[model samples]
Each structure stands twice: as structure tokens, then as C-alpha cells.
Target: MATTFQKCKTDEKNKAYPCASTRCKHPWTVRYREPGGRSGRQREKSFPTKTEAVDHGVKMENDKREGTYIDPKRGAVPLKVYAEKWIGRQHMATNTEGTYERAFRLHIYPALGSRLLSAIRTDDIEQLGRDMTTAGLSANSADAYLTPLRSVCKAAVVNGDIGRNPFIGAKLPKLPNKAVDETQLPTGQQIQDMADEFRPEWALSIWLMAGLGLRTGEMLGLRIGDFQEDHVRVSRQITRGKAGQGPVIGPLKHRRVGDWRKIPLPTNLRDAVRAHVAAYGTGPDGALFKTLTGTLVAASDYATHFKKVTKLLGFEWSPHDLRHWFASTALSNGLPLLDVSRWLGHKSINETADTYGHLTPDSTGRAVKVMDVAITQHRAGLVLDTAA
Candidate 1:
């Protein structure tokens, strides 16, 4: 038997909502009241057969359960509305708020601003990746931009607003592997030369960064109280951004409770830090580093000064390069990876090994010496011949 679906209208004038199929042969109509209100009844018209009307009703009921159905007349919602809702629900850490804000302003809104939330597809996400790559954005940067959108879309799916996350199937660009650039590290002699060329105040900070491997944020966050006669306690670090920004005084990255130990201050560095403090004691709230206007210095300002000092010394490197130098130099000087990891506040020794693996030498002479001693002892009958 062949089956046909028909469009129809329902009876009931007071409840005059329109339906596609009707029971009457000539012009059966269905009427239903507006949903959730006492507004005027909406009417649907013209079903030639009773079977057609029943099938339409069954389909509507199924669509409501599956959440695939949308009223044809109601329009789509804008993306910005959903974005605001997502932001409000986000429980971001203090250090991460600025990053989220930047991602929203620079990436998400600009790329997907005009698109309807319902119409966004995986192809749209893939196109975003391609366009970002074409525009010279690094693969990592492009990924960062897309990550927030993925989160937003995931939220939509969880809430039943959408069926699936579009970003799940989108192809992303390949990210470059990050390795330390050895050229950036200054040699021991170069460090001395820079210290000699720059003012004591400027040189001191550079020396700490290069010699002690302190992050710029940690350096700027140093307080008078953090420094003792023997060692410095790295309890807090300065995060870059505007005032009232959270995470101003959080523990060091990957730092465990017992891991926060004191780093002994070298004689020269200790003296220089003392002198700088004597000259510029606690600003308003006892901050160690401050601006000319006597306010806490921003990280960018510290970086500017660092660059100026490095330039004056004729060294073309970033402040972070000094930390790399510290790690590399320590490894080259035969410091064990575990010791270096602890000194640099790394989470694990594996991190040190991975970062400084290139610095390891063959140690063939030491191995040969051990082998010779073992052979002589074995021949002299002083030791057991394990090789035999």
C-alpha cells in the first residue's frame, strides 16, 4: 500500500493555532490558542484527510521531545547574547582573567560576531583556522583564539541549545615545537661585561634574572620582607595587567607547599639589592620596585628598563633568556638535573632534563677510567669479574 502525508487545519475556534492537515474532505481546519498566553487564537488550515492531520500532530510531538524543532516564524538569536551568558558562568582564576578577556575581544567577537548561533558550523570554524594561518598568526596563537569558541559551543551543547559542538571536527593548524634558543644566553664573561657597563641598579636585576633564574614577574614582585640576610623567600609574584586584576599574590607556578625554600643571595647581588632598597625604600606599600612617580612598577616598564640595560651593554637578548642561561650554564657546569630543577622551582626533574638535554656531554673519559680500574682489579684477583 502507498502512503501519502497531507497538510491540514484543525477544528476548535477558541484554540485557533494552525496545523497543516485536516479531517474534512473539503476544508477541515484546526484552531489552537497561543502557547503560554491569552492572546488571539492562531489557526491552521486545509487538511483533506483525517490521517494527514493525525500524522502531523505526532511529528510535532516528537520534534518537541528531540529539541530539533523550531517555530518557523521565530528568528535566530545573536552570538553576543550567548557569549555574555558564557562569560558570566566562567569561574576563571585570577591570573587567567586577563587572558580570557583578551581572547574574547581580539578573537571570538571579531571572527564569529555576525553569524547566527544556530547557523555556525564546523566549516566556519575550519575557515577561521585557515584565515588565521593566512594572516600570519602562529599555530599556537590561532589555537588559543579558537579554544574559547570551543568552550562556548560545548556549553551550548550541554544546555541542549545545540546538538553538537562544531569545533570538535574542525581541523587545526600544526603548532611549532618550542625549544630554548641557545644564542640568547649570555656567556659568563658577557654577564660580567654587562654588569660593568650598566648602572648598579639596572645591572642588579639583570644579574638576578640571569644568575638566579627568577621570572620578571617574581623579580618585580619582590618585597623588602621577601629578602633576608641569607636567602630570599619567593612567596608572591607580580602578574602583568591592570589594577584590581586578581592573582596578584599567588604561589609560584608548579610550586608545592614544602617546595617554597629560600635561595641564598650571593654577596654581590645581596649588596646591590640592599643599596637599591636604601636608595628607594618601600614606595607607598613597601613595594621593592616602583616607577619614577613612586608607584608599583608594571612588568612592561621593568622589561623596558631591562632591555635598555642589555642594549647599553650591547647584548641583544630578552630578560627570559637569562633564565635559560641559568639553566644551561648550570647543566654545562655539571649540576645534576634534579638539583637544577629544585633550584629553578620546576615541578619535576624531567622538565630540567627536557629543557637542557642538549647540554649533556659524552663523558667517555670518565667511563674509560672506570673500565680500566675494573679490569686491573679483576686481573689482580681483588674483585669479581662480573663480565665473565
Candidate 2:
């Protein structure tokens, strides 16, 4: 049950002044218990008139009885507070977690962090995306940047902090074609030119990537024992499993522990690995390559040299481009798409075809030939039947 009463007002001097029933003109205060009748916690709110106060009190009691009551305070929590907690609960790679944290700090916090969870409107979210695009990020990049916030809002809905996610059906900016552009891939001579910029050990690493179509992390995680005369075993990669911890030896991308794949070793690649082994011996635990100081060749450390050489060579390319070059070269040389996918250790053959199908050797010519053969056979049969 709820009761209405008028509370005393304060003067400009910050002193309480009492008001009698005859002269009382203060707002009405509604005092009531929470959902469970007398057992529910006592709560209070004030209204300008007796009627509004009575209506709000009745609605509160009924909503609680129906088990649909959401604490007004829960929705008042700041988005930043909730979002930080959300990040802590996610099971993600260290680097990815780091990226999300950086994005939230730089992009989200300044704009909508102070807003209450219930107050964050769909307009605010769509506006944030536009702001990112105006700052020169692609529409796809902006969308990715908003992923953590979008997830946080959805989780809030489930937690009963808000009724619905503001992100649902919002009009975000459009993205362009995402298919791989073969022009970004480096050529054979360009690969060698960049390789020559590194010392022999690291140079061989570049060649292994291009020849075997292996990821940079997979190449860095190689062991001397993994190399054979005819093939190489890919079993692990250097990765950071948890946020804040440095990279460690982890399973390959898109693979579970103990899963492995093997790629055929061409004669030239085999000779290159042998030459590297002969020259520098090997790092601890049979690691095929490492820094001069014998540390695991980390991507951040390796990228410094890669960037310097690419800048000097007057070309913009990344280590992964070497892998793309290998796939393109193999596809152009008549290797089957399925074989290329296997060589690259892709999760599926369709993945390889989707990215590099345009590079398939003489695809248009082969289609034309097939069509011509079908037409000629049909016409020949028709002519023979007419003659008979």
C-alpha cells in the first residue's frame, strides 16, 4: 500500500522550514512497499499532484505483482561502467581484447560513455558510426569498431537493464566489396627483393611463406624437426591466448589443440631451408628461426624490419601478402583450387575459391570450349537424324 504526504521545503539560506497542513503547498510524496506487499522493500517517489502520485504507486505495485518490475536504478547505470564489465567477461584472444579496449577508450568513451544505459538511443549509435567514417575509417571498419558497444547494449537488454537494444535495425553506413584484390599481391621478383633486405635466417622465413602459403605466425612457430625433404608439418602458431600476457606457442588458427596439417615442399624450398639450417644452426627446442638474440621472432618485432624494407623498396605490402602471392601463383599455374586450399591450410576449399577464383588459369577459355563442344555434339546428332 502507498500513502501520500507533503514534505517540508527548504529556504535559500539552506535551512529547513516547517509547513503546516493548512499552508502546505509542497509536492506530494508517495511512500510504498516493493512488489511483495509488506515483505518487499520500502521505496518512495514524489509527484506534483495527488492523482499522479497515486497512479504511479498503483502501477509499481501491480508491475511487481506481475513479476515484470525492473529497478529504476539498474537502468541508470552509466554505459562505461557496464561496458568495462562486459569486456572482462569475454573469452577472446589477447590481441583482439586489446583492440576492443583501445576502440572503446578512443571511440566510445568520449561520446556515449557518460550516458545511462536506458538513455543511449539508436540515434546516438548511428551518429557514432558516421563520426568514425568522417574521421576516415571505412564503413566496414566503423561497423567493427561498434561491435563491442552493440554487444554490450544487447546484453543489457537480457540483463533487464533496458527493454531493447538500440542497435537493433539501426541504419549504419554501407560497406563496399570485400573480395580480395589480386593486385595487392607481390610478384616473385618483388618477394625476393624484400627478402634480400633481411639477413639470411629471416630472408628464408619470407621464402617459406611464399613457397608454402603458410601464415606468418605458423612460419614463426616452425620447428626444424617439422621440415622434411618432401613436406612440412604445421602444428602450432605463436599467439597470445589471454589479454595482457605476451604471445606463446598456441594451436593454429581455426584449429583445436593437437590438430595439424602438412604442405608439400618443393625442391627449391627444401634447399633453402637446408641452407638456412647449415648456416645458423637452430634456436632452442629446434625452432627454425628466431631473432639474433635468440628470442621468439614476434610479429611486432618482425614488422619493424618489414615496414622499413617495404618503405625503402617504394612498395606498400605486408607479410600476409606473401601468402596471397603464393595462392595466386599456384592458381594461375593450373593447380586445383582444392589443392591450393589444402596447401594454405584453409578451413574449406570454398574459402580459397571465394578469394582467388578470379585468378584461376584460363577460366573463361575453358568455359567457352565446354559450351562449343556441347553445341557441336547436339547439332551433329540433329543433322544425322535429319539425313536418315
Candidate 3:
């Protein structure tokens, strides 16, 4: 028979079956057979009115018929268990996995780890954001932690543990824009001054970074052979691997084997590299830049040294600031934004525009010039017509 609901009065003598006493504490029951089962199952729930019970039973019946019913018991697994399984099934880079794991341990686990998967509601997820803020996480940091939780919830929806993602409509906190205001990062004169003032040993690397706009790993990954007649090849990088593991040499970020970018070599940067190579020599594997002891340059070491140098000069900058300077210089020099993006190995031109759009030539003035020419031509045509 089809699923059905009945109003029942319950008492201590007959709790499972219905009793007719009006004073009975519990009142409603629904009878439904599990999918692919011959026997029936009955569940008792408290309902204020028979109409509410009937409506709920009808919805359950429809869900079962549509093969979308999720037995509440099936989702009773604790969130901690589900999250572990979900994270295990993810195929991601080791560094990304480490990041996700860190976020889970730092923010997600402590708040909702003990709750059942089905018991969590939208309000609970909202409270998680609030709790992260209360714990003194910045807006960006809190959002980073919440990213893994959102992914986990999405997986749960696919697994039928939840009908919908609770965090779907929730908004993450906004981060304030902290970008520096400059059309082109330090002009030609300023760059020359910085190069002159920087330590002799480090000047070449600074010039290369400002010239090529390479990421830190990419800059450190360069080998003598990568520099050719008129360009530099970018095919490899060194970056931190999984948590606790140190730096690892690997393929360039977001690329596969043999996928490399080639950027034109500027004359000044080429001269600096040639001079630096003559003075210091390459690493064992021909790394262009190496420590005094001839080992691969570590990012941590570079950061420490750069910080001290910039502090001494009273300049507020990081290694990455040089790359931004390169992009800004390229854009402001009338180079095509798309070309600049390719040279910098950006994933797309849109990324290039978003990062350095402010440095692009003024489109409004160009449009006005075009319109002026068109209007001038039209007026000349009218003058000729009158003379004819």
C-alpha cells in the first residue's frame, strides 16, 4: 500500500500504536515502506494539528515516489566523519590540499565538528563566519577558512546527505582594497636609482624582476640555459609542497611539462645578467641566481634579506612589488595589455586587464578623436554639396 498518515493519541500502555485518549501526550504517526522493501515502517512525530501531519506525510510520499527521499537516519553521520571522507576524495595539488586542511583544522572543526551532517542549518553556517571574525581573523582570512566548508557542503549535497547547501546564499565579508596608487611603478629614473642604491650582488636580480614581472618561484627557477639570444624561457619553478615538507622544484604553476613562457630580454637587463654571471657564477645545476655558498636561493632567505634592505632604504616594498612595477611599466608604455599578459605568463588577458587596467591608455580621449574626425569629414561633404 501507498504511504499514509494517521492521527494517534499515545499513552504509556501503548506507545507504538494509536490510543484514543484526548489527554495522551503524543499524537501523530506516518506509515511508509522503505525503498525496495516489502515490510512497512512507521514513525511517530509530534504535530500540533492533523492537517500539518497530513501535509508532511504527502510530501514524504511524493519524495519517495520521485526517488529523492533521504532517510533521515542516513544523514545522521557526524560532520567530522563526512568531512574527512570528502576531503580524502578531492584530487588537488599538494599545496592546495595542505591549505584546505589547515583551514579545516583552524576554523571549521572546532565549531561544527560534532554536529550531525543533517542537523546543520544555514544559521549555523552564518554563525561559523561570525565565530571566525570573533576569533580575530581578518575578513580575507575568515573567507579563506570558509571556502573549504562551502566545498564540503557542496559535496554533501551531491552525496544526498543534505538537500541543499546551507551556505549557498551566504555572503563572505568584503576585503578592503589595499592596492598602491601609481600609474607606472617607479619610473625609469627611479628604477635606475634603486638599481644603483641596491647592494651590488642583488642589483641584477632586482633588475630582472622589474624587467620580466616573474613570480618569485619563477625568478628563482631560472637557469643559465633558460636565457637565450633575445628572450628568457620560463618552464619550471620551486615552491613549498605539502605541509611540513620543504620547498620542491616542479613544473611552472598552472602548466604542464614543456609548457613555458618566453619573454623578450631588455638590453639593460641582459647587460646586468651578463655582468652578474661573470662575477658570481651559476649554481651546480646552472641556476642563474644562487646563494654565496652556491645553493639554490631559498624564498625565505630572500624575503628576510629583502626586508632588511628595504627597511634600511626606508622603502616599503616586497619582491612581488617589482613584478607589479614591470606590469605597470609595460602597460603605460603603450604595450598591448594582452601581450603584457602573455609575457608575464598570466592565465588570461582579462587577468592582465584587471591587474593593470589603470595604466592602459585613455580610451575616452581616443574615442573623442575618432568622433571629431568623422564630424569634420561630414562637414566638408556638406560644404562641397553646397558649392555643387
Candidate 4:
């Protein structure tokens, strides 16, 4: 796959009796190409010394045989270019795509975007994370900002754009360990109190998030068609785009198109939906919540509204906190953990447990009491058998 040679300068008669350093600035050159389909792709790199040239040539040949060969020159492609291409091929959700792009533009691009993919070492990636943290971002926030870089580097390695992923086996910043508090959740009455802070059109946001455990985007993306008397179909969300662009409807997090899950519509939430529909008559796209001018509600727009409501009520809870209250209330009331996870649209039961697993101190006492009752019943059955 590669060869090394010395091209010494000839004399005036176009003949060279001996090679010498004085005659040529870079006499040694490594000629390399991939295997089989490497035709017309032959390229060369000049080196100051024969040993350096030959070493690189051998490594290239070995890499080709090992099936991990990439055009050494192609690795020079800027990270931003490769990252854009990599993200484009991924077909990610709109919000996720926007996050990746924003991460690149704000954090990663300025530091490393122009650097060659081949040149970025694990140390550089780790250092960038530290720099972001030192720049006042929390450890978790820094890691979140670096996620796009980590993913892009990983993909580069998989696609052979680079030899290895810098992120793999690298020590990354960790989120601070936190003790879960069950009291973080709000009560149904508390939710209603917050709902009263807004008009019916916007009040439904609080109900859906608190009552149904809907995510902010999912709540904003709700439409009349997605709602039934008995159940609600959760299939899409509102996702932000580039800075100046408006949010668009996209598939639910971690789900593909045409995939949906039904959450049972409770009697109260169902009645609330009907009242709102009767008053507002739905927006142009049958959306349950919208502005007065018949436009789709964006998550950011509603976030601003929620901040105002929190200021007014002094409840100090977010829309997401309402969803958390839904989960906490369900779990505390004996709802199966797996069912709670499903209703919250969590990716896995483990996630639900990690976030909402903390319960009250009396929970274990309740478990023991139930066990006592079971044992008593078993003893009674044994005595009845003996009597028979």
C-alpha cells in the first residue's frame, strides 16, 4: 500500500552519482495508496529524512491490511465538515439535531472545529471539557455541551474517518451525586392553583404536564385529533430549530414515525380538554393550545409564560416538575413502576427508578405490615385444613 524513496537532485548534466543532504531540501518521500481500489488515488508526502518516510509508509501498508485504512490526506478534513455530514446522515429528531448544531457553534467549533479529525487526541477532548467547566458551566452542563463532539468523534472512528474514538475510554466529567427528594413533586391542588394563574387556553399546559406527565414539547404539540375520550395518543413533539427558525412538529423522543403510545385519559383531564376545546375551538391545525391569533404554540413561548406563572404563584415549580409530580403521585399511590415509566415515555425502567425511586420512610413499614397480614392469612388456612 505504500513505498518510500529518495529523489536526490542531479548535477547540471542531469546525473546523480551520490545522494547528499545539501543537494535536496526534502529528498525522502512516502508514496501511498489504499488496496485494490486505490488506483488514481496515489498520493505522496515529503519528509526530511528516509527513516521517518519509511516508518509512515510501513504503518500505512499495515493499516490497509488491517482494513482500517483511510486516505491519510482525507483525515485532514476539518471536524466541522465531518460532523455536519455525520449528523446529516443520522436523521435525528429536530430538537436533538438543533442541540448538536448549537453545541458545535457555541462550544466545540471555536476550539476544535478547524482542527483535523486525525489530530484531535483524547487529551484535547478531555481538556476542552475542563475548559468549558472552568468557564462557569456546571460539570453536567459541560458534559452535555461536549456530547456532540463525543458522538462525532465516535462516528468518525466507526466510519474510518479517523483511526480511533477519542471519547472511548476517556475520563469524562460526572454529574454531581444528588439525593432524590419525594417532596419535589407538587400536589394536584397545587397544579390547579398554578392552572388558575392563566386563561383556559394556556391552563391546559399545566394540566397535561401535571396530570398526564407530558413533556413540555409533547404538551405543546398536542392536537385535538391526538385526544380521545378514554385515552390520548402521544406520538409527536415540538422541537426547536436553528436560532432564527421556529419550532416544528417531530416524532416523540426515542420513537420513530408512525409509532405512538396511548395514555389513559382521566375523567378530570378529559373534562378539562372538552371545556378548553369548546371555548377556543382548536387552532388551524387542530392544536388544543395556541395563541389568540390561531398560531401553534412553541415550547419556548410557553416557557416564558410558565416563568411568569411561577412568579405569580410563588410555587417555584417548572412544567417538568408537574410531570414529576404526576410520576411521584402515581408511584406513591401504588402504580406499578413499569407502568409509570411507560406513561412518562421514559426510555427504560432503570431511568424511572433512578429519577423517581426515592420513596417515603414509611414505605418499608407498609411493606412489612402487608407481609404480616399475608402470613396471618396463611396460618388461618393451615388451621382450617387441620379442622377439615
By TM-score, the candidates rank as 4, 3, 2, 1
Candidate 3 on 1-388: residue-level lDDT in tens? 3433334433445544566666655545555555665654654344665566677677667877888876767678888898899888887655466668878777788899889988888888888888888889888788888888889888888888777688877765676554435653566666666667766766677778888998888888888888887899888876666666665566676676568999999877777788888987888588887777777776667777777776776777778788888888788788988889898887777777777787888889999999989988779778878999
TM accuracy, model 4: 0.79
**What digit string (tens of lDDT, one per residue) describes model 4 on residues 12-108?**
3334425565745545778887676646477788788878899889988887788777776767888888888888789777778888888999999
lDDT (0 to 1) per candidate: 0.67, 0.82, 0.76, 0.81
Write down the worst ten-residue block by lDDT for model 1.
1-10
The superposed Cα distance between candidate 4 and the true structure at residue 97, in angstroms, equals 3.0
| Per-candidate count of clashing residue pairs (backbone under 3 Å) | 24, 0, 0, 0
Give each prediction's root-mean-square deviation over alpha carbons: 8.6, 6.2, 4.8, 5.4
Instruction: Count backbone clashes in candidate 1.
Output: 24
| C-alpha RMSD of candidate 3 | 4.8
Residue ranges of candidate 1 with Cα displaced over 4 Å: 1-80, 113-123, 129-140, 143-147, 150-173, 192-200, 242-251, 254-264, 308-315, 346-351, 361-388
Q: Using TM-score as the measure, name the better of candidate 2 and candidate 4.
A: 4
List candidate 2 segments past 4 Å from native. 1-76, 93-102, 105-114, 130-144, 154-162, 170-176, 240-244, 345-351, 362-388
Error of 1 at 156 (Å): 5.5
> How does model 2 fare in lDDT?
0.82
Cα error, residue 15 of model 3, in Å, equals 7.5
- Cα-based TM-score, every candidate: 0.65, 0.71, 0.75, 0.79
